[model samples]
Target: MNQAIDAIRTFNRFFTRHVGAIDARFLDTDANLPEARLLFEIARLGPVLANVLQAELGLDRGYLSRMIARFEERGWVARDRLDSDARARPIRLTQAGQAAFEEIDGRQRDAVAHDLESLSATERDDLVQALTRARLLLDRQAPDAFTIRDARVGEVSQVAARQSVLYAESHSWGHGLEVVEAETTAAFLRNSDAERERCWVADLGGVMAGAVFLTDEGEGTARLRLLHVEPFARRRGIGDALVAGCLDFAREKGYRQVVLWTHTVLEAARRIYARNGFECIDTQVHHTFGEPVQGETWRVLL
Candidate 1:
């Protein structure tokens, strides 16, 4: 326990120093760290309740009230009482506040770029994986505790990256997997049909825990693509939920049937597909990922 505490403290100290290197004075914009924090938080989740903000950041109520008042005085924020609860008020960034946030955000990005500009691609990947593991451990998020939502801009590539990393680590799949996933994902976005297809991501604690894509395959048939969940985030019914969501969307889109291709080795996913009414229609051995694997095609009548 002492060693774990010491390790955590060491990381905390290192992070503090890292931020100090980034900008100790909030990029010299007259705002201290706390104020900068408040500004950025408000900017992202503005129109958010003060109590919610305080709770999310673990800020003292009194301290948060003071900082909010300061922002209001600077014409950077405004608060409006909630109709449901008079004591509850939501804070929002004013136009001036938004401009300030943009400036601060831009500066922060530039500072980060300048700070880590020397790292190679491999080093950056290492750092990101380290950070992801740290977050997954520290947040202690439950496997099923995730929100299924529409895949947003720039997240498709992230989905590909997540799949790449996980597959490489777990299955020893080569770069070919990432290449196919990336190309298919990009094409999914480029040629998305609003009425016929959809993409859903399992957003676990703001991280991409899993993702599933449904694409139109013409002839009243829809194809389910890229169905996967992070290993750490498995077994919480996320996979089932994602598959169900895709099926529901397909039904809503008037598809007569749905089909999916899966590797036989993916037992968990196979179970999910089976539970969701899919039946294996065909199978073939392929050396797609530089190894011979049995791939199965499953189909279900909608």
Candidate 2:
């Protein structure tokens, strides 16, 4: 625990340094980091509101008011008057504010692009996945930022690899798990019926953090397979959302029932299945994932 705390602290310090947060002027601009971010938000989300900005930035009401006042004093923003609720005016950027935002945003983009130029393609991809994973763990903020979509070409392996690594880390699942995951994923891609069978990936800011597969089991039954979410990306409805996607697809394909197999060790996933109206219909002690385990079969009538 101490080691983990120290590692997180070290990374926090490193990130602040990397972003030049120690500087008085952010991006060498007139405003500091918080003020600069507020400026960007106003320009992007304007005609935006103070309360919305306040909540997004996690700033105290008084602090955000002062910041907005400062921007208004500088002629960077103007609040449009509200007729009914005079106290709740929306803010918008003036030409001056627009210029300021463009300057700061352009500089920041250029700086990040310059930094990325130093890394190889593989390293860049790894860095992005790592950063998004960290943010998801810290804020649990992936629900809105994620979109469910059909798995793209070559993503079958990606899904399998992510699921395999996550399960191995969280449950100490053995090598056979990866082998099975890879096999099933490849088979899905190779033989799945586009209308009756499908796999969806929860794309979190371009990273595949969760996946579920719906496959025809003959006679109006669809089986959900390989429902998994990265540990850092769990508990934010990604798992449930994946399952929902599976059930929705199953229904649309005219399937009468959906079934899934899961282990008793996966309580989180069990809840997801149950929440989706699936009932545990059978259980058995099986030697799988390198150990004896209570496996469950759940089904939902559509």
Candidate 3:
């Protein structure tokens, strides 16, 4: 523990001193850190909605409004109304602001890269690899950002049809996947919501890619069921996102833990759950789904 604490402190000191983040530039000028950060964000994601910036940065509406006003006074930014929403406004960096931001951006990157280059090539590669691994691990452990929204009417039928087709092809288990008609799924979806059972469908580019549901498990716990990502979206991290979203919703609804039951044949899902801190607590032989399969129960404390 002492070694770990020391390593973290050393890294923090190194980052602050050598990273040349926007905060450092604030000191060089008389400007403050918040303003500098706002400028940088605008330069990077300008033509972005104001509300998006507020959520992403966790800035107060009043503070952001004042900052934008300041930028506008200096002709450093411009605001335009969103076409889809008349009341919504998006900000963009003006020509002068873009040029100024570009110069600062180059300096910031160069400073960080130069410090990193102080290390040997082999050392740099190893450090990058370690950081990448740490990020992947952190993402698995962290709370998911996806929110639980109301599923549109009849969304379950679409998801079930998608899931049935997938299971039929992927698992040798049985025609059971083909046997469970859409009516069963439609009933489940219609009865579930944010309060009782959480159900969600992932929509990208205005199309539903996947869906998952967590029904009441009794005793302050919930069971994650019906995790299905469409074939086209299977490898795109959608499954992990769905699982994380379900767990997050479970926590929000005052659950103490979340559990899942799945066949051992689904190695990918198992790994995702395990990485997110789920542990197998039970197993059994099941003849359901028309296949003799070994089912495992996994759980994670909220």
TM-score of each: 0.59, 0.73, 0.49
lDDT of 2 by residue, 76-156 (tens): 999997888888789999999998889889989999999999999989998998887777778764454678999877777
| Candidate number that wins on lDDT, 1 or 2 | 2
Residue 232 of candidate 1: its Cα lDDT? 65
TM-score of 2: 0.73
Q: lDDT at 23 for candidate 3?
A: 61
Q: How far is candidate 3 from the true structure (C-alpha RMSD, Å)?
A: 17.4
- List candidate 1 segments past 4 Å from native: 1-10, 15-133, 138-144
Number of the top TM-score candidate: 2
The order by descending TM-score is 2, 1, 3
Q: Tell me the whole-model lDDT of each prediction, alpha carbons only.
A: 0.85, 0.87, 0.74
Local accuracy of candidate 3 as per-residue lDDT tens digits, 170-287: 8753456555546557657556555768678876433466788788868998988778765544556778888888888788889999988887889888988887889999999877
Count of clashes, each model: 0, 0, 0
Best by lDDT: 2
